[model samples]
Target chain A: MSEERTEINSLGEFGLIELLTKNIEIQQASTILGVGDDAAVIDHFGRQTVISTDMLVEGIHFDLMYTPLKHLGYKSVVVNLSDIYAMNATPTQITMSIAFSNRFSVDALNEFYEGVYAACEKYGVDLIGGDTTSSQKGFVISVTAIGEVAPDKFVKRSTAEKGDLLCVSGDLGAAYLGLTLLEREKQIYLESPQLQPDLENQTYIIGRQLKPEARRDIIEFLQEQDIQPTAMMDVSDGLSSEILHICKQSNLGVVLYEEKIPIANETKEMALKFSLDPTAAALSGGEDYELLFTMKQADYDKIVLSEQISVIGYMTDISEGAHILTKGGNKFKLVAQGWNAFQQ
Target chain B: MSEERTEINSLGEFGLIELLTKNIEIQQASTILGVGDDAAVIDHFGRQTVISTDMLVEGIHFDLMYTPLKHLGYKSVVVNLSDIYAMNATPTQITMSIAFSNRFSVDALNEFYEGVYAACEKYGVDLIGGDTTSSQKGFVISVTAIGEVAPDKFVKRSTAEKGDLLCVSGDLGAAYLGLTLLEREKQIYLESPQLQPDLENQTYIIGRQLKPEARRDIIEFLQEQDIQPTAMMDVSDGLSSEILHICKQSNLGVVLYEEKIPIANETKEMALKFSLDPTAAALSGGEDYELLFTMKQADYDKIVLSEQISVIGYMTDISEGAHILTKGGNKFKLVAQGWNAFQQ
Candidate 1:
């Protein structure tokens, strides 16, 4: 009680991390890199090592009212694996740690792990080690994934370049819209228990929110095409926030085309039904888990035709500012309003 | 409720992990090892990789009634670094994730991270990445530690040979005794609200329980002496259980000396006060976080003697059985009563 207490909000998450790590001394000669990338890179046994971790808590990250445990398990793995892919590394191993309240019967945990197993199998990642303990309340899952890449082959978010072609894989904003639909349905169901909800047409958008996939295939495709992204990151915090990250880190600006933005047909339809703008959803909706990267124009011919890949925007000098070319060809300044769990 | 339900208890933790990992395929050639050992081993550009993870849940692992948030933070990192040291690797990078209930004020979290920062500075590890989110109840901390070692220098638990000398670093059972004392005090305080429990003389044991240190120093000492352990593991799950792990994995048996089992004077006194046997406490009491290992007998002369390192036993042929030689010259079988959190 004698110790002075300080508010975590004062330090924030990033500030706390920096304060904790500021005095750490790297003593190992083999620790080529540590604590500063999408993944912790270790130089060991002549290979470049990559490690990443993510944790998700119930209510904070998901609501079980509409979220299935199986999808939650799959998404947990996908989110963590996304960090490995962000480093341009191939994930090979993962350790899952979970804490569950007694309210969850043993059967529920089995169902959760079933989905986790499916994800591991689908991604070709080994479920290596983990710990399970009793939580005081709702379920919590933490996954740490280890990956590998050629020493020089790994891409970092800090390497974005001026005039690089900014690209994104697959469509975006569906997950956010999907989440909104689920929340509204839950509210309506609560108000009138006997009302039958309409969900047949919203499956595609809902599926994106409930079960997201890491862009591991995109990593493989890039390798096959012999093209390396100059800088890359996963679109977990929306396109606007992710682009801002690259721009800030790479010291450049970006120009995105609103008309060229890839929004799935289902997503657009749902946006209209909800009276929401597809562009707004694409810009601000999070948890897409898609890849956003920058590459040289020369390599465009190799990847442009790929079905899973999309060219959403390009990078420019810092003075150019981040702009979205509207469908009418007018320039609009881009802004980032990504989800920050800490912000009230 | 209509979904088919299966129980997780039927498949235990290890079984569940096995089931989940059965179909996983490693896609990266640089991943030298995964899903086993203390941490996943990746082949980096220059050195060998080491990684390990540990999860601590409130109520199951610790009681916030007597546990300071700062100590909990420090202990979490120590538990993880201990595993890295068990592999004879250098602790370098760590990612920490936590879930806290709203009952915990933001000030409490800042205090917790301050302790984490202190330990990070003491251990020379960087806080690279992590996630923080709201917990429905209680607190959960998950830490993943990454270290590095030379390919040839990395120690494993499956290499002990016959006649190998079994060694342990530091005294044992103090942490367990500390828990017993704290529990008694807690019960007493619960019975009488006005009671003030005296713990002036219990500092050593209580500190062991509250702030356990990882044996990274032993690793440095061994390297300085150029003595490589044939087999090694951290004594996190009691001395007997850890020894059994090495024996089972290495296909060997052990003959332990009762008198050689190191116990601190304070720990012995506390056990006697609590009407418990000190030696028994040292054998099966968990959470000591000390190093227990075996080395070839011929290498003993190369390593200098230190008070911290005690020769407790010798490995023998599997047929010999794991036996403890008492001062009375009677042989007794060793049993591992390892802690299982899932058990009632």
Candidate 2:
């Protein structure tokens, strides 16, 4: 963002696309072709390809009032990459398409692509083919991540067997609480433009929301340790919602121990400040981008090798039903309180 | 066309996705997993995978007043498939993500998916994965089509040699004329609500704009004839612009004959009604979704087997420059009047 603004129409569609993609450095050997083609070509060398897609709309998904363009770009790619990692696949390439209103400028998109390239560089994925178009209103982004996995090795939610140790990588609920804080700060700023946003130096929680990373380390560690989860999924939805999906899809019940759920100190502190239950946030707050998985009990010793991993519960027979044993010694039926964007 | 309407929020995001995707019967042998997972899986069976993406925004790329939801759905998929086919590949799967405001009902989405499935059935591509979310404004669709090509057989736009025969498949400019007609009708309807719309029975042009098909037949025909194109791309941004791209990318020049550019009889009639030159319309009016390619002169004999293809030009040395020999025997330097959505 500079004082001088160059209109998008000045460069036209082809010129703008060339400007945006000109700096892309392809990193994947699987990416036989990257950008500047009708379609990108990939040769996975006999590996099964895994693909996932995600769409984000401004105002509905993010308020640009506080979100930086670069972080927005990074998070967009990271979210789709999380889905690929959840499938136990190595992301190799991505196609990103964006539609923006006249409000966006070339410089604005340049800053955004700076973040996109940063993520691509860090994650070692190639920026492949995409579409650039104009929108009638706010900015919209759609990203598709492509990955590869060894044949028959890709994890699925429907394969968690009974007695498997339910686990998760990294902390949960920070991103949701971070969003709550940002929204509050946004409201305050709208009412008092002169006043500065009091983020309370909650950098950890805020960073979780603005620049969350896909749990690539967990996947890599698993690969290094030869510990394959029977079932796994990324927690874009809340942990409770994701747990319900594994249970429903696998036709197995699960007993989640609320006491064992991992929450960072900052997340817990922020929850208490907001008068929200930390456990509740951990269960129902979404967009953590952490990996939730179930592994065989025999691998428990190996799983503990990573200090980031937490054993949350165990899968049970379907007859037992999905439930959560609360820290207060109360057993409650688990329900999917996943954040629904369509909620009225 | 249901008497009862179900609100999208009533079903929630997951429920809506389930309803839309529940009927998908996988049609591709490469699609190992479709929907109901974090990501979809595909195995290209040693063939190189081709991927392309497109995003269409309502009011920007399409007008809902004249475009049926079903046709919009079908066109969205077809446009992406066209990119894949441009690479000389057989499309196998697609991921469709859409964001729509609450102004739409669940039944409306059902109709859109109806057309999506129709295209999938016709193209024999599996609908694998997608993201459905709420938009703050109009409908936005993002589709990524995946295809497979025989190893080292996928085509590129930068491989045309001098003296290669430049060709195009199917007719062009009809879609642009059709859009012009629709816009005028919309303007009339907007200005006078009492007036009944008169389409003038321009079915062919209208259909080209509303539900254009990808040139899958041309690709199939080429494969059957073993006629590999030297340079190739889909005619998306008008013939003049596409030809310029071919020349610039291939580092060669082209001499196009305006008389050889195929314009359907209906297209010519519509252009005349609009008081526009038919050849100019064929050169500058886009959204044809037709194949534009350069083939070896040796393959020229096999190319005529399909009545759909027409030899429009020949590749030339760079020193010859890119020009069009007009019907009146005037040679003009080719300029791209490609449709620019970002135009002020």
Candidate 3:
């Protein structure tokens, strides 16, 4: 990084926002107005709009010691977009509000916006209105995503039927394993400044943690294949926890098979290296940003043709309760041991 | 003010969210689904949707020493609603995301939500969605408001003409005075515990600061009177600064009269008590969530009929520049010393 530091106070809040958003091009036809104004205007004439919000606090959601600011910006946008995709909606616009202390310079903010712009370019979403202010301590980010879906195509998490088959896109546990590796490396670097991080060998898992992508492609594929999920959500708080959320909301029970859970080979190896159970890691590890849904059994044939998806379970009557069947022929109740920031 | 305190960790994140949002009745016909889903869905079929977001950090935007949690919650939501009304739109829904340290308890959160619920009821807007998580330090709030306006009825800050008359709703500078009084009381209390705050005579100004309301009524009155503003914005950052924004965006200039500025008698007295200029306070002191707008000269008669409205200025040619005409007939260029959070 170059040492050319520019004080944020030199340019006022409005100046900084204008500088950052100057090159943002509106690609969504629904967005009638963006940035520059008191509020953004959108005209989604025939489609229903979906809205979701998320906040990430420094030291709570991420550590600056191990995470790059650019990656942080990208991941922040991706996380909010995941919620939109979880509703089977195509994200059209986002408003990003950030507060940072004076410890950061203007160049540092430029790098963060570069990542934000890159994400906007990749997703073809417009950057709308936002508030930029100062924080008393570390950095804080809040993002709100707006999306559009056909009136009859929007999905909810409380409409799954008892005979629906549970499905998830992409492999699980990699992001959590990646987080463990990064935390370990951060500890080693803190103890001895001369030791460089041995991150080359763990590139895949590290990328999973640092740059997880929202499954917009999955939503598109489901639409192309004419498959409408009965209930859907993103695997942000782990597969087991998300499954339990769907079942509880739908007033049904579920039976998940341990062997059917898809854990990447690299993630499984890393879990064992840390002396952790691979199955448990896949079940309870969070932040994968993958789509998890329940579809009718009749739609199973259409989904099985896609290699990116895995069928892990099936919904059952409410009397059966929620449980996981082990490969060794044992059944245990599934509990939500997902990561909670307030646990300490 | 209750002595009952329940630890947040005992109920977990999901339980706490459920408890907070269980009774959030959806009042807007546009809101299809709320709270329980991954994203809330709204159907604004023929109307143009307006979106705005604002973030309030604990120590930066407000001080907890004199700010009740309930009042803080109410003010946060009102500030965002003010932006929606600035666009000549009727706010329909809001998403409130908050982060706080564990020093807060469930009872404290309930108090905050009570205020949020009160604002929703008063505005007839639905609480559609939000994210609640832990912060490492003080409290943080991010609120996003969504509103709707007719396709051609929405106002912008860049549409004023040279002959338009400048108008303002309600008196200004009172919120800043209220803040000064609160800070003084806090200082006195810090010096001697036995010194009780003498706030009995400062009720009006203090209330203006702590519980500022968005001018939804002004928007309604304009619609009812068949009057549309050529340009409009909210006075969150004081009159002079907002006037400069309108002039710059609209490629015009303005001439504001000092004698015409609407400073309340209570605010003038409070400013004199603190040895501050009342006109300067009205010009630069911020946080007065009033509406500043421009209308055709022909509409002046209709606006003056309402006691709440004031005609303060008029738009001029671009070469004239923005200036304030003093009561003594002296003219001075209006510089935006508006509240810049980045300035030390």
**Number of the top-ranking candidate, with lDDT as the measure:** 1
The sequence of per-residue lDDT tens digits that candidate 2 reaches over residues A1-344 is 54544444455433544543444344334444343321233446666777888899999888899999999999999998898898888887787888887676555766677788778778877666566677889999999988877866778888899999999999999998999999999999899999999999999999999999999999999998899999998887789988988998799999888889999999999999998887778888899999999999999999786789999999999999988887778788887762221121
> Native-contact fraction for each model?
0.58, 0.35, 0.37
lDDT by residue (B157-225, candidate 1, tens digit) is 889999999999999999999999999989989999698986758899999999999998999999988
Compose the digit string of candidate 3's lDDT tens values, residues B239-293: 8888988998799999988899999999999999999888878888899999999
Per-residue lDDT of candidate 2, residues B52-164 (tens digit):
88899998889999999999989999998898899888787777888888777655766787788778778877666677777989999999988777776878887899999
Best by TM-score: 1
lDDT (tens digit, per residue) of candidate 3 on A130-187: 6667788999999998887786677778889998999999999999999999999899
Candidate 3 scores an fnat of 0.37
Candidate 2 chain A minimal-lDDT segment of 10 residues? A32-41
Task: Tell me the spans in candidate 1 whose CA falls farther than 4 Å from its real position.
Answer: A1-37, A45-47, A104-107, A188-197, A224-226, A297-304, A316-321, A328-333, A338-344, B1-36, B103-107, B188-197, B300-304, B328-331, B338-344
Query: Which consecutive 10 residues in model 3 chain A have the weakest lDDT in total?
Result: A32-41
lDDT of 1 by residue, A114-209 (tens): 788788888888776677776777888999987877877888887988878888999999999999998898999999979987685787889999
Top candidate, metric DockQ: 1
